[model samples]
Target: MIEVAGDSSRDGDWALVRLRVEGDRILEADADGLGARLGGLSLLEAAAVPGEPLAVDALANALGPIFRARRDSGRVAVAMSGGVDSAVALLRSGPKAIGVTLRLWLDPSGPSAERACCSPEAVLAARRTCHSLGLPHVTLDLRESFRRAVVEPFVRGYGRGETPNPCMRCNGSFRFGQLLDFARRAGADRLATGHYARIVERHGRLLLARAADAGKDQSYMLARLDPRRLRQIEFPLGDQSKERTRAEARAAGLEAAGRADSQEACFLAGDDLRAFLVRRGLAGESGAVVDDEGRELGRHDGFWQFTPGQRRGLGVATGTPLYALRTEPRANRVVVGPREALARRRVRASGRLFAPVERAEVKLRYRSPAVPARVEPASRGFVLHLDQPAYGVAAGQAAVLYEDDAVVGAGIISSSSAT
Candidate 1:
C-alpha cells in the first residue's frame, strides 16, 4: 500500500486530496469531504475536481521527492501518453520507473487542443497515472522544438504535394532522441515506451521487429530510427497483446485503461489535415485535374489535397471511378486515372539502411501487405523490384523493408514505376 497527497488550485479555488492505494486499488481517499470517490481515481484525478485549482507543473514539483529517490535506483524512464498501454508499461517496470511526458505546442488555430497527445490535458492525465502508483512524473516543455522538428516539416511536405507521415519522423527521430537524452540526464538506466515493437539481435547488430500482436504492430512507424540508439531503448509491451495490456490496467484500477487510443498525427487531433494546413498558411490553390496525357478532365481547389491512389473527394466525377495518379506541385496539377494505373512493380526509394540486404519483403504502406522483393544497392539509395504489383505507391511515403518480421531497412519512396 502507498499514500499520496497533492494540492490543486484552479481559478483561485484551492483544494487538497490525499489517498491510500493498495495493490492496484485505492483503499481510501480524503479530500476535506469533497464527495469524491477516490477509491478508483488517481491522486491527480482527485485533484482535478470542478473548481479545484492545480497547475500541472506545480503538482509535478510537489511530487518531486518520489522521483528523486529513484534517480539513483536504476530507474527506467517510461514515456506516458495518458493511455492504458503506457500505464501498464510503468506498472511492469515496477516502482523504480519514472514517468515523462513531452508537452508540444500544437497548432493553436486547430480544433480542440485538449485532444492532442501532448496537450495539457494529456500531460495531467499521465501525471495522474504516475501518482496513483506512487511514482513520480515530469513534464518537458518542447513546444518550439516540436514546431521546428515535426510541425513545420509536415506543413512543408504537404505544400510540396508530398504525403509525409509526420508520426514516423517524430517517433523515429525527434521523440525518442529527446527521451533518451532525458533518461541519461535523469540518471535512469534505460528509456521505455508503450510502442508495440521489439529489439532483437541479428548477426551481432540490434534490429527492431514486430510485436506479438501483429495487428497492433508499430514497427513500421519506427523503422527510420538510427540503429545506434536501439540498444538503449526498451519496449516492455512488445510481447503483450493490446487486449492483455488493457486487462492489466483495468485490474489495477487505472483510469487510462478505458481511454481511447491517441490519434496518428497528434498535432492534427482529429482536425482535417487540409484545414490544418490552410490555417498554418499553407493553403492550397485552385488547380486543374488532368488525365495522364495532360488533358484537362476537371477542376480542383488544390492539388495538394489529393494523394496518389485516393478515389474520393476528387470533386470531379469521370464516367468511371477515378484515382489520383500523381500530384505535380510545380504545375499545380493533379493527374487522375483508373485504379490500375496506380500499380507499380518497382519503387526507387531514397534512405539509408540499418543493414545490407539482397532480398527482403517490402511494405509500401502501413496496412498494405509486405510483398517479396529483390533489393538492389544503388548510389544514392536502393531499389525494390516486387514480385507482384502493389497499388497506391506514393512518393514521400516510407518504404520499409523487412526480413522475417525484422525491419532490416527503410527509405522514402522517391518514385514508383509500372513494370
Candidate 2:
C-alpha cells in the first residue's frame, strides 16, 4: 500500500485528505481540515472524482497513482479551461470522456486573478461542468512547473531586451506536455482540446493548420509543437467557428456559454506587463531614450520597458514622430528613429522547420499579416528573406513560416536587417 494526500484552501476554509491505496483500490482513507466537507469517501469511490472546491483539491492531488495501472483505449481526455469552447469540446467528446484542467500559477494580488483560465475559480468551474455532465474531472496542480517553464523565460527575455510571447511557449511546450502526460497516467488513449487549429498530413508528416474561422486561427501560437506528438492529440473545435462553440454550449445549458474569453499572459492575471515585471524584481531604472545618432532624446524608466517598433511612450517631441528601434539593456538605453528605420528586409531566427521549403509566408507577430519571404537554412535555425520590408520585427518573438494555411516551421527572431 502507498500513501497519498491532497488539500485545498480558499478564503479561510480548507480540506485535507489522505489515502492508502494498493493498485486501483483504496484500502484506507482519512480526512482532516478546517471544513465539515473534508473527507476521502468520494475519492475512495472512484479513481477520478468530480466535486466542489475542496474535493477537487483532494482528488487532483491524490488520484494520479491510483489510475495509472488502468488503460482504456476508448477513453478521451478533454482539456477544460472552464470556458465555453472547452465545455463544448467536452460535450462533443462523447460518453467515454474525462475532463482535465491544469491549475497554473497566477499573481494573487492581481485585480483579475479570478478571470485567469487556471485560477482557483476556473478549476471549480471546470469541476462543476464535469459533474453536471456526469463525467469524472481531474485537476493537475502544475503551478510550479508552469512558472519554471514559461514564466521565468518571459522575465528573462524581457531583461535581455526582447519581447517574448509567453502564450506560444506555453502552448508549444509547457501546457500540452503536462496535459499529455496526465492523459497517459489517467488511462486515456488520446488527449483532446478546444484549440482553434487543425492537424493535417503533408508528405506523411503531421502539420498544424489554421482553423476554419480565420479570425480565430491559432496555428502561429502552436507552431512549435512537435509534429510527432500530433497523433496523440485531437482538436475538436478546429473546424467550428467560435459562434458555433458558444451556441453548442448554450444549447447544452453550460454556464460558460456566454463567458468572456480569457486574456493573454494569464499569469499576469490582467495586470499590465510593466506592473508584472516590477513585481518580479524588474524595477524601473532611469535610462536614456536616444536617437539613431546616439543623441539623447528623452528620459525613460527602463530600457526593458520598450521594444522594437514601439511608437508611443518615448516622451520625445520632434518635427516628425520617432519610434523605438531597439533596446540596449546593458547600456540602459532605448534607440529611437524614423518609422522607415524600423523596416527590415531580413530576419534571422533560431528554430526548426517541419517541412523543407525555399519560400513561404512569414508571420512576424500574432496580429501581423503574413508576408512573403524566402526561407534559408541556418546553423541553428532558419532565416526569412522578406520580399518587402517588414516593420517592427522584434527579437525573441516567433517568426512562423506557413505554406498556404499550414504552419511549416517557426523560430525566434534573433536579429533583423535592411539588407
Candidate 3:
C-alpha cells in the first residue's frame, strides 16, 4: 500500500486530498481543507465525482502518480490545447484516452492572455471538454521550465540581434518532452496531438513529413523532433485539413469548434513583439542606422528592432531604397544596403541531421519557399550551399532541410556568406 496527498489553492479556495491505495483501488481516502467534497465515499469513486470544482481540481492534479503503476498498453494520452484541432484529436483517440494540458507562463500584463493556448482559461476549457466526453484530464504546471527552456533563449537571442523562433524551440524540445513524460506517468504507451504533420519511415528510420493539406503543413516547425521518439507519438489530424477538424468538432458540439487559432508566440499574449521585449527588460538604447559603406543613414531606437530583409521603418531617405541587411548588437548599429546585397550562396547552421543527404531543399523561414541546396558536413553542424543565391537569410532562424516532403534535418542559422 502507498499513501499519496495532493493539494491545490486558487483564488482563496483550497483543497487537500490524501489517498491510501493498493493496486488500482483506493483502500482509505481522506479529504480536508476548504471547499473539498469527498465525504462518505471511496476516493476512487470520488475520482469520477462531478459538479465539485475544487474536488476535481485536487484529484486531477494528483491522478498522475496514482495511475503510474498500472501500465495500460492500450491507453493513450492526448495533448489538449482547448482548440478545435485538439478537441477532434481527443475524439479520434478512442475511449481509453486521457486529456492533458501544460500550464505555461504568459505575460501577465498582456491584454489577450486569456486567448493563449496555455492560459488558465484554456486549461478550464480543456478540463470541461474532457468531462463532457466522460474522460479524465490532467494539468501539468510547467511555467518555470517553459520560461527557462523557451522564453529565456528567445529574449537572449533577440538581445544578440537575432530573430529567434520560439515556437520551433518549444515544439521541438520542451513541449513534447513534458507531454511524453506525463504519458509515461499516466500509464499510457502513446501520446497523441493535433499537429498537422505525418511521420514516415525511411530506411528503417522515422522522419516527419508534410501533411496532406499543403497550405497547413507544419513539418518544418516540427523538424527538430527526435526521430527515435516518433514511434510513440501520434498525429491524429495528420492527413486531414483544418476545415475537416472544425467540422468534426461542430458535429460533436464541442465549444472550441469555432475558436480562433492561437497566436505564434503564445507567451506574448497578442502583444507586439517589440512591446513584449521591452516589458521583459529588453529595452534598447539609441543606435545608428548605417549603410554598407560606413555612412550613417539615420538614427534609430535600437539595432535589435531591425532584422535582415526588413524594408520599412528605417527612417532613412536615399535615392534608392534600402533594406536592413544585418544588425551588429555590439556596435549598436543597423546595417542597410540594396536588396541585392542580401543575397547569400552559403549558410552555416548549428544542429543535427536525422538522415544522411547530399542535396535537399532548405526553408529559411516559415512563410518562405524552399530553395534547392547542396549539403556539406561542417565541424559541429552543416553548411547549405544554395543552387541559386538565396536572399535575406538571417542568423537564429531555423533552416529546415527537406527531401521532397520528408524532413531530413533542421538547424539554427549561425551565419551566411555570399561565397
Candidate 4:
C-alpha cells in the first residue's frame, strides 16, 4: 500500500499509487509504468519502463551517483496549449520537465473556422495534465502583448488593403520569444512544444523540416522561427502521428486525452470578425467599392474590414462573379472585378528572411499548396516567380520557402505586380 500525508486534489503532499488490477482485484504497484501495470508501453512513452518497488530502491541505491550527476543538468521546458499535442509533449519530456501555458485572448469573431491550437480552455487543460503528472506548472498572461503584436497588425494590415497573417507573427515573434525566455529563466536548456514541425542540422545550420506525418505538418506556420531561435526549439510530436500522440496521452491518463483541439484566431472571443471590428471603432465608416478605372460599383461599411482575394459577403452586384481584387486604403475603397482579376504571377515580398536562396517552394497561405518559385533578390526585398499564377495571393501575408520539405526561409508578401 502506498501511503502519504497530503491530498491528491490540491497537490499538498501525496504518493502516487500505481496499481495493477485483475478484474477489480488489487494486485500490485508496477514501477515500469508500462503494462506491468506500467511497463510494456511503446518506445514513444518515456514512462513505460517497469520496475518493482524493492527493485527500484535497490537500483536507486545502485545508480544513485549517476542519477545525482545528471540531476543538475538542464531539463526540457514544455509549452502546453491544452491539447493532445502539448499534453503529450509535457508527459514525454525527460525527468526535469516543467510546463507553462500562455493566456491568450479569445477573439470575438473570425475563422473559428480553421481549427488548430490555442485558447483559454487550453490553459486549464495544460495545468490539469501538469498536476496529474506531478509536474510544476505556470501560466503567463499575454492578452495585451498579443493585441499589440498580432491583433493591431491584423487591423492595420486589412486597413491597408492586405491579407495579414497574424498566426505567423504569433509563432515567430510572440510564442517562441515569450516561452523561450521563460525556459531560460527556469534553467532549461531546451524548450519543447507540440507543433508538428521538425528541426534538423543541415549544412551546419539548424533548419526546419516537415513533420514525418504529412497530414499534420506545421512547417509553414513556423517559417518565421529564425535559425537562432530554432536552435533552442524542439518538437516532440514531429516524428509521431496524431493518432499515436493521442494514444500516448490516453495511456498517460492525461485529462486532455479527449479534449478537443483549438480553433484558428481563437483570441477573437467569438466567430464574428465584422462585429469585433465594429467594437474596435472601425465600424460605421462606409466607403466606396470601385473598379480599376475608379468607377464606383458599390459601397462598403469600411475598407479596414476587408481582405484581398475575398469572394464572400461583398454586398456588391456585377454582371459576373466578382472577387476582392484590391483595396485602396487611402481612398478607403475596396475594388472588385471578374474572377480573372484575382490571378497574379509575380509576387513581391518584403521583410524577407533567407539563407541566400534564388529558388524554393513557396506556400502562399496555410492551406494553399506550395508551388515552385524562383526567388530573385530585389533592391528592397525579394521577387517570387510563380510557375503559374495563383489566385488571392495577398500582401501582408507570409510566403514560406522550402527546399524540398525543409523551410529555408520565409517573407511577408508585399504585393503582386501583374499585368
Best by lDDT: 3
TM-score per candidate: 0.85, 0.94, 0.92, 0.78
In terms of lDDT, the poorest run of 10 residues in model 4 is 60-69
Pairs that clash in candidate 3: none
The segments of candidate 1 whose C-alpha lies over 4 angstroms from its true place after superposition are 1-56, 59-73
Per-residue CA lDDT of model 2 for 151-205, tens digit only, reads 9999999999999999989988899998889888778899999889999988578
lDDT of each: 0.80, 0.84, 0.84, 0.69
Q: What value of lDDT does candidate 1 attain over all alpha carbons?
A: 0.80
Return model 2's CA RMSD, one decimal: 2.5
Q: How well does candidate 4 match the true structure in TM-score terms? A: 0.78
Model 3 scores a TM of 0.92
How much is the lDDT of residue 346 in candidate 3? 96
Report how far off residue 294 is in candidate 4 (Å).
2.6
lDDT tens digits by residue: candidate 4, 206-310: 889999999889888888877788878889899989999989988877777887777556665446767776666565578898887888888888786667678
RMSD of 1: 7.1
Off by over 4 Å in 3: 1-49, 62-69
Please give the TM-score that candidate 2 achieves against the real structure.
0.94
Highest TM-score scorer: 2
Between candidates 2 and 4, name the one with more favorable lDDT: 2
Error of 3 at 169 (Å): 1.4
Alpha carbon deviation, residue 322, candidate 3 (Å): 1.3
Arranged by lDDT with the best first, the candidates are 3, 2, 1, 4
